[model samples]
Target: MAHSHDSTALDLPLPARRHQTLALVLVRRLAGHGLHDARATMLALDAGGTEFRRLLVLARALVVDLARTSRRRILLAPCCAAGMTRDEGLLMAMIGGGGLDVHGVLTDDAGCAIAMTTAHALGDELERLATRNDWRR
Candidate 1:
């Protein structure tokens, strides 16, 4: 006798699936909020324009709860007056001395590196939080 084989699979864990669904919902909400498309948003941000700055600000704001829960420290660099810098400054200030550190730099390149470093540090904290079962499900 011959047997037929099927190769389709869905391998996500329950909590992970729920988290992914929540993320998708958030993405849809972002798109509805004038982010256009996710790919377009990524391109725009990579291109570094006013829209990019706005999108970054929105993205950062959306992740504030996660940052707080993770006890992440963010160092913000000031580059423009178009609101992103202002908003990040406000966020860092709100986090106070222990939680986040805000630094203003002269060039966009320096600012980008600082932001990247902050993100890296935050990622480590988030990982630790996850390992310790401190992350919200």
Candidate 2:
């Protein structure tokens, strides 16, 4: 499903789908197994209701996934519009716990660039992961 430019609400078949998609994309850049934990967190959060909970959950999932997979060398290129919150910080902490480094990259000045870059990066990561874990193989 296509995401809106001005909204956090995801257009997905189910909350799980949304969570998985976001998690898969976010985890690819990071360096180790934290992605699995992050995905679980996101799934739980997706079942809850709160202010921007879905978006927050998705963001956290990505952070944790990256941290778990990457060996402490992941940069968080967050959109400026993607305001930082306590949940986000918590997610960062989780990523850090997974032996990954986190750096923040704000993208308020260039929304389009940020969006494109994020999409590309996420896509690349997902593809790499899929290939590495080829279930069909």
* C-alpha RMSD by candidate, in order: 18.4, 14.5
The lDDT for every candidate, in the order shown, is: 0.34, 0.34
lDDT per residue for candidate 1 within 1-137, as digits (tens), equals 21121111222122242222222233334434444446536643543344345434444443443333332233232221122233243333332222233322212222233343443443333343344443355
Candidate 1 residue spans exceeding 4 A from truth = 1-111, 134-137
Model 2, residue 20: distance off in Å is 5.7
Candidate 2 residue lDDT tens string, 27-128: 332213343446444443443333234434444444544334332233333322233233233233333231112222222222223222333343344334
Q: Candidate 2 local accuracy as lDDT?
A: 0.34
Candidate 1 at residue 71, lDDT?
28
Question: What is the Å distance of residue 2 in model 1 from its true position?
Answer: 59
